[model samples]
Target chain A: MAICAKIDTYEQMYLIRAFEERIAELFSRGELFGTTHPCIGQEATAVGVVTTLEPTDVVTSTHRGHGHFLAWTGDVQGLMAEIMGRATGVCAGRGGSQHLYAENFYTNGITGGMGAVGTGMALAEKQRASGNIVCSFIGDGALAQGILHEAMNMASLWDAPILYALENNLYAMSTHVRDTLAGGIVPRAGALAIESATVESDDVFDVIAAAEQAVEYVRENSRPYLLELRTYRFCGHSINDERAYRTREEEDEWQRRDPLARLAGALAETERRAIEGRCRARIERAIAAARNAPVQDLGDIGKGLWKS
Target chain B: MEKLTVGRAIAAGLRKKLADDPTVYLLGEDICDPYGGAFRITRGLSSEFPGRLINAPISEAGVVGVATGMALRGLRPVVEMMFGDFIALAADQLINHAAKFSWMYNGAVSVPLVVRAPMGGRRGYGPTHSQSLERMLLSTPGLRIVAPTPRHDAAALIGAAIDDSNPVVFIEGKLLYAAEQATVSEHYDIAHTHPPYPAAVLNNAAGEQPNVTVVTYGPMLPVVEEAMTAAFNEDEVACEILAPSEIGPLDTALIGESVARTGRLIVAEEGPRSWGWAAEVVARVVERWGDRLVARPVRVAGRDLPLPTARPLEDHVLPGVETVRGAVEKVMLQ
Candidate 1:
């Protein structure tokens, strides 16, 4: 069954927005450790693309990966605990926000390194004839990282079953995509001989339709495809970022097309309110459980360092 | 037993693992047949195991990152860097990604990946091609480093490294690839410490007292052995040699035990002087047995400089038989 068929993506997007908003509040209060890059405005991209994937298909995510993690695993408790540095965290409190791992979901803080890793995983699935594909999520900023290009070339040359889902949020920290990126986005993958497609919208359905096709191309052909999703980040680059790089008007413009509002606009007023109420309650409960969870023992620091 | 060169031995080890385990794979540049490997380590194995051995592009970081991905998917991958110096290009993958995954994921995943690189400067490969850069990788946490000597079965050690659950950087002495294998002789008693990834301990003459314990690894083993023999013949000084196959997660216990008995220590390596493996061995032993030594510990390593292309200049930068002999003689006097 399709993941979208089972759950309301509108609620999921609302949940991600509320969860990230709570995280920002927590960060302001010094409740969370390390730093976080929240995908507040781009929840639709995570929900739309991941819902199109199967449970068996693996995903390699980026530094700003909480949305992807939430959308894929739906383990809010584990993700919350992980962010709070608790022993019950998905990674046992070690990976924090950027580095996370589950059975089929993997993430690292490195911007573009996972591209190669995902390609390799797709190649492995192809070799095993497992009929599973991989979705490697990278931002437009990741184009500066040489490994992504190398990975794309390798994937095309090897005919690996993988989809490079590039979330173009228009900014890499203080710099816009125009300043860092050259030769545009889609053609970059096209130049590597990879099939490409693009979806430009805040609507989750548009992204889902495009993602389904891109994923099908990879699965059916047993080769790589590039899916470029144009989106925006409603939050700053990180918790501490001041947003000095852009104006309030620009933020207001993107906010008008905010995924949550767009999705809610399509729903009845009561339905939107009920979904928001449920998502808020669920997030609050996860936060409480995560906050009460014990910290990992420092004496066993080397516990997972090796497999023994 | 038919004697095999270090290259052939490594190939045999890889072949054994590939045949034994279905998940084991080989990935590198020009590793497939028609070209084999740059060092020919994967020579004829490609034909034997057809689709298992893959030839990758010149992208070092991509290859290693790909190998890490494969390892995460429950596959054992062994990647080869054409030259050890080129490992610098893949440092991000090996150090950041491969080394951090098992711990970062909190044991949810393990990368049983092996990266083999031919190290050491000889035969005028110039500054880039010929370098012992394994020292640069020693500081990486959760990363295992092994430089097997000819005295031990290189094949078995390589096999052990491949079987290891942790990511291992297998440093092959480029000079030792074609050299004839060395055998245990009657004049020495050979025993191993730490099974699986063992270190070879050669105690010359049974039950005899030694004045100094000389610790070395990789190609330096032969030079230290020769120096020990010379010191014994000339001055009747009995010296023990301990060659650890595993460098990081170093078995300092064995070295400390030998230091306790001998009360003298000399560490020799092929890499440059300061912050080299030699210093690490000495510091570890000294930290454990402070002020117990009769004289100051000596480090016999390459000169603190880049290896030049010229033969005389290169020879001067790198340590040889004379360098090892000088260290032994210097400590013997004190």
Candidate 2:
């Protein structure tokens, strides 16, 4: 059972990597419109944290949220079509890459904005006594937003069932985390008296373990918890980033400990090869379907402005 | 007919909604017992529905943001901004998240959230506390703006706003909190458009055609009404007043038809003169009835300056009965 779960985790991470790689290629070829924030190196955090949530448990994500979306739903075609701006898109191509929604899944482009939103959702769940927890994801950059702190205080004070997953990728856009952030992220949550833990690893299994413990604590105690995943972005912030801030050696150093490669070592070479091939083929099919989908009509511009 | 003040009417409306729906919850600053909100609208509500009337901190943005989340998660959350001026703090959440959710998600979800704000200047709250900032929230798609006036049924309007699927910003006048909301009048025959928050129309009971169409909403409704009464009694000026409780998706059809009959227009608002609701009404009316008017429409609005703390200065800054009557006379002449 453990081995099967491990294989599923590895498969999910590889699928995200393949999807992002294709997105990058599509952007470079000018096949996709609008900007995209690819979570190339932060796949393990999204997969590990999201896979721990129940179907009733809600999750809120940020601008770079494709990894989270895919991990939770794994609807490659819907996401691909949405990103490609087709009528068959998740939000009918109106939300583009920054905004997305599913049954219990929500994504926003604003940094740290979902902190309050997730807390509110958790409060609602607590009131219902549904035993459902909410997991909100933000980056290290979101620490600058005041709404996050406000949300943390409210969540702790109310003892809302929520888990705040902060993926510290070391940089916010071109600025280094050290230059932007003043204090430690974990200690900041601790100052608010929110139960917190930090997992410094590129391994998917470690993230999953930490997330499981955090989710359990939040659900059991009906309290808010924070989990900090210390990782590195293997690719630039966005597809068109020039990568002028960091050195090639620095990139190479993080690349050596790639989460995909680390997980692949646990599997036999044949199994790893077979999984990678299948994921790549699935991504290709999604891209073809997205490309073939029709664009929305101009007359439908005012369709969803107000719910009828 | 029971003469209910705006505050009591809104409180009754909220109480009824809470009793009716289990999913309904109220979030606001000091909304519970001992401090029945800043204006006492939520007084006794806390005792009625324990755990439902949440006492939020001074975090305005968090209150609205969390309410948006609650709405997204199938809860009808109504938030109260201590003062409408402080709504500027929650602009990002209201404008970006709440307003955009329905459209952004392609109607996948709806935010049935109501943010009740105590607006307008009169109680000497100075700059930060006293303001008609609805103009700042204007023109936002998927966001409904409704303000109950003295002539309209405040409770019904609030009920409609809460029952709405989209996010509605319910603006309540601070002065109107204690004043009587007279839904009936003897001088003018009162009528309303269809439900889901309707525009209240006032015409002369004598069946005389009005010479000027005065369009207003919220706090300015009474001021315009008073001005029209003064103009009528003193100078035999018949002006039809159209005060819609819903201002954002404003029922411009009523305004246009009234203006077509009068052939002269006077739009009044409590906000500043530049790019206010008055401006919107004038632009919309002109666009609809271009080259079909007796004279150009006139707008009555507050002076474009920060409201001063002094009583005299504040009165000078905000639009008064005299200012509205002057506009009525000006439009009547042309």
Scored by DockQ, the top model is 1
What is the Cα-based TM-score of model 1? 0.98
* Chain B TM-scores across candidates: 0.97, 0.98
Local lDDT at A307 for model 2: 74
For each candidate, the DockQ is 0.81, 0.78
DockQ (model 2, Cα):
0.78
> How many clashes show up per model?
0, 0
Report the C-alpha lDDT of model 2 over A255-290, residue by residue, as the tens digit.
999998888889888888889998998888988988
Q: List model 1 lDDT by residue over B1-334, tens digit each.
A: 6667887888889999999999999999999998899988888888999889989999999999998998988889999999999999999999989999999998888889999989998779889998999888899988999988877788899999899999999999988898766657655678887878888898874687888999999988877888788888888878889999998878788888888988999999988998888888888888988667988999999988988999999999999989988998899889
Model 2, span B262-302: residue lDDT tens: 89999888888998888888998999985668999999999
The runs of at least 3 residues in candidate 1 whose Cα sits more than 4 Å from the true structure, single-residue gaps closed, are A1-7
